[model samples]
Structure formats: structure tokens, C-alpha cells
Target: MSPLPGPRARGHRLPMVTALLLALVGTLGLTGCASLGTAAKYDGGRLRIDGTDLSFRLPEGWERRDNEELADALAGSEIDDELAERGGISSSQQDAILDEVVLFAVGPGGSSLNVLTSSEALPPRAVLIDQVESFGGTDVRETDFPTDVGDSFAVAYRLDAQGVQADLLAMVIDTGDRLSVITVTTGSRAETDRVAEVIRTSLALR
Candidate 1:
């Protein structure tokens, strides 16, 4: 594993998943239209997150929730060292822009699936996985795979946070104008592998 890069002005050094959740919760009050107004449609068991052209099948038994609902649930929680100096603006200020972020979250029982898009371009895969593990994820393994859209970067890891031990499959896909981080969280590695294949096959740009 590479050394954990020092914190950047945009806090790129923070794990993408952890950093984004905290940032979203903090800025929810400042956003009205962008955070709550973005459109997502579900048709034929597939969900299309508007603006990002991210569409994928909703895994068996999984249900989708809007990002604003997530922000509301997580608003009171505080995360340390994750939001340091994001764009040299106050964490709350940086979070205010989260209205522009696109997020799709699904879960079945104790597992979850997330698709997120932001204007910020992410670093390459290796660096991204390292950053995630550094932020309390363990047993990280990189999985390179092919997708209909293009080359895909994926990582399998276990995250123990808030008393939950979540097995996660994280994939990064660059869509020219934004970066999409798709994560599948479950208790079984077999399940993660199975779902990862479905996501890669289904992903495409519109």
C-alpha cells in the first residue's frame, strides 16, 4: 500500500466515502434546490440518477433513497479530520455546495449500495483505495475490471464504523464531466463479487 498522502486543500486525502457523507450532512441546511431538487427515476427495476447519466439495476431486495433524506438522517453526526481545509473554505461552506452532488443509495437488510457523482475528479484507483483503508477500512484488495463504458477501478474492503462491519466493493468510473463512485456494501464477499459484475455490465453513459 502506498503512504497515505497528506491532506490536500480539497481534502482529497480523506476517504471518498467517509468524507462525502460528513460533508453532505453538514451542508444540508444551506441547500434547498440542488440537494433536494435533482431528479431520479426508477423504471423496469433500474434507476437513473439525473444529471450524471448513472443508471443501474436495483439489486434484489434493495430500495433507493434520496441523498437529501440521507443527509437529514446523518446531519447531527460529526466526523473528525475528514473535512479539513476542503478548498480552503470552512467545512460547512464546502458542504453547502453538496446540493450539486449526485447520490443514489440503496440497501437490503444490513447491506447497502451507493452511487455518487461530483464535479471533482478523483485521483487514480491505487491512491483512492489506499486512502480508504487509511481511514479505518481493512483487508483492502484492488479489483480491476472491464465495463461497457470503459476501464473500471474497484476495491474490496471491510469497514467497521459506528458498530457496523460492512464489506464493501468500491468502483470508480470517470464520466468526463464528473467522477462516479459506486459502492456495494454487504456481509458476504461472494455477494459483493456477484453484484459488482452486474454493476459493471449495466453501467453506461447517456
Candidate 2:
């Protein structure tokens, strides 16, 4: 058995893990994501998303995905193949499910964030626990993860058996009327902190 990851490998924080996701934001491009309604643009100095109340601007160096075919956009990245190889998870299956929930994505693939809305309503913590386990998560820890998303039940963990042995940060934000999931995965533990910070400040509720 391998040794558990140190604190740095654990992650910073975010919303919640769902199906363990990614795709480089760079490959997708700001121009490609420049569609009319769903793109992440500062409206009156606030970043807004089309389908959800959640909003958060990407970090200075980050890119936003405006594409409707989120999974296909992600398919252009290497993270899925890594997940498949390590966790025995299927990329096509993951993509199919993601296509349904993905509202916006950030990053350049190796490290990234995905925001998806769900109405599954199985209890926030329960849903969070189950999804992490499903994605082969390990070393799970509850987090205060820094977010404006409101009393989020967040967690950080190693994406066990997947993604080049990377870290994952997830959050489950429940607004009584809706639930928004923020999922991030990286090729290294180091990326987790930065991505989590992105999630923390990303929400721009409409």
C-alpha cells in the first residue's frame, strides 16, 4: 500500500465532487466559448452564468468555457484518459452524464473546474460522500474551503485510483431551492489549492 498524501496533496477547498471531472480551458479557448448566453463575462463588473444563480469569475490566468457540449470539450483533454486508466472509469460514460449537468468549466485541462447543477436531493452530505466514493476518492476531509456560496458542505481528497494520482476538491452548495456542484481535479496535489481558491471566489449568484 502507498503512503497517504501529506496535507499539501489533500487540497484547498471548493463545492463538491461529481463524477470526478476536467479538460484544459486553454484548448477550448475564449473565442470558442464566446457564445451569446452561457459565456462567463463580467456583467456590470459581475461574472454571470446563463443557467444558474451561481457566479464566480475565473482567476486572472484561467479561461472559461462557453460551449454547450461540455463533455465533448473535455474529451479534448487528457484527464479523462488518466481517470480511465487508473480508476477503470469510462470516459464516454462520464462525458454522457457530464453533458447533462455541465454549465461552465475553467482551466486548461490538466487542472480544471466544472460547475454543474443537480436536483437529485439525496441530502447534501450523503450525495457528497457517495459521489466521492464512486469516483475512487480517498483521504477525504471536510473543508471550510473558502466560498461565498453559503454554508457549503465541502470536501477535499485524493482522486484515488485516477487522474495521474491527482487531488480533487468538491463542494455541494444547497440554496434550499437548488443545488450546485463544483468539481475540480488536477494532475498534481499542488494544483488543488489554486483551483479551490477559484471555486471559493467564483460564485456570482443571480
Candidate 3:
């Protein structure tokens, strides 16, 4: 309209167009960031074991496996049929039910501990300590039966059970209705000691 818009005016219009495109891009980026920030929430402590929600703090960089796989690894000479008969279930069902029994003993240098509900009355704390010591190949460094935390005890030790050597530690927490035993076995003395501390620090019910 005014002098038909000279070349200089056209160049100015191009810059304005570029500015508008930049603004649109910026707006889109902000929207994306906001969406990502407002994503769903989850309880980090809850782990899915055999489709069951079991709460525990997962150690960093450790891998998780199913019960069947673990049972196969720690099977020994135990017959699947015999195990199932005790629980009135098939081998496959028993595998699913006991999936959480075996946990990470420590990859490479770790051993496995099978957790089970105390079937024949609650065994003495000394019995557990002795079993762990015998299996771990280490003496019990410390044991404390805290009355406050479900009358459970924390046991620390160094073990060299079988060919695999490790620093083993466990928290035997029994809540009358349920008993949870968290055991950590390290590959080397140093790694075992480090993980033992981590397990102790990360120990919690919820």
C-alpha cells in the first residue's frame, strides 16, 4: 500500500516470519517438557515378584530374575514333585508361589538364600545365625534382635560357602503374620563389604 513495499521492507518481513517460527518451536518444546514433568507417579520401593507387589529397595546395577530360573540354578537334587506335594500344588504352581524365595545373592560372586515361612514353629535366633555362618563360611560379626521392628534381628557376617566367596549379611524381620529375610552376598571381600553396608543403609519395611 505504501510505495508497494520496497526490497528492504520485504527483508524485514522475512525476519518477522523467522521470529514467529522460532516462537512456535519454543512453545512446542515447553509444552513437551511440561507433559514429561507431569507424568504418572509410582512407588519406587515396590518391586513386582511373580506379579506380586513386594516392597524392597533394589540395589543399583543388580539384575532381577524369576523364581523358576533361580530354582533351576539352586535346584541341587531336590525333586520338583516332592516340593509340590508338601504344598498341595503342582511344580509350576510351586514355582510361582516361591518365586520371591530366592533373591540376588550377588551376581558373579554371590550365593543364593531360599526364604520360607517358618513352618515348624519359629526357630531360635541362634539356629538362623548358625545356619548363615555355616552356609556363608564366616562368623557372625553382629546380631541384634530389635523389639521395635517386628521383633526381627539384623545379622552381619563374612561367608565363603561352597566355591563362591562373599561377604554375606541379612535382616531377619518377622512381623508375626509374615517373615521377610533380606540377604545380600557379594562376590569379593571388598564388594561384599560395600554391598553389606548398602543393604544395611537401605533396609526398611515400607
What's model 1's TM-score?
A: 0.68
lDDT of 2 by residue, 86-189 (tens): 33447665554556555555554435566666554424465566656665667877777555655576777775332135566766675544566666666655
**TM agreement with the true structure for every prediction:** 0.68, 0.62, 0.50
Q: Regarding TM-score, does 1 or 2 come out ahead?
A: 1
Better of 2 and 3 by lDDT: 2
Which residue pairs in candidate 1 have backbone atoms (N, alpha carbon, C) closer than 3 angstroms, thus clashing?
none
Residues 1-206, model 3: lDDT tens digits:
46763221111221212212211211222222211112122334444322222244445654444434445532442344433433345656645554435342223323322233321223355665555443323567655445443556656665332233345455565554445555555444466556545554554444
Q: Write the per-residue lDDT of candidate 1 for residues 113-198, one digit (tens) a residue.
A: 65666555556766766666555667988887667764467877776543445567778776656566777766667877887887
Candidate 1 error regions (>4 Å): 1-43, 77-101, 120-122
- In the order shown, what is each candidate's alpha-carbon RMSD? 9.0, 11.5, 26.8
- lDDT-best of 1 and 3: 1
**What lDDT score is found at residue 111 in candidate 2?**
50
Best by lDDT: 1
RMSD of 2: 11.5
Instruction: Please give the CA lDDT of all the candidate structures.
Output: 0.56, 0.53, 0.40
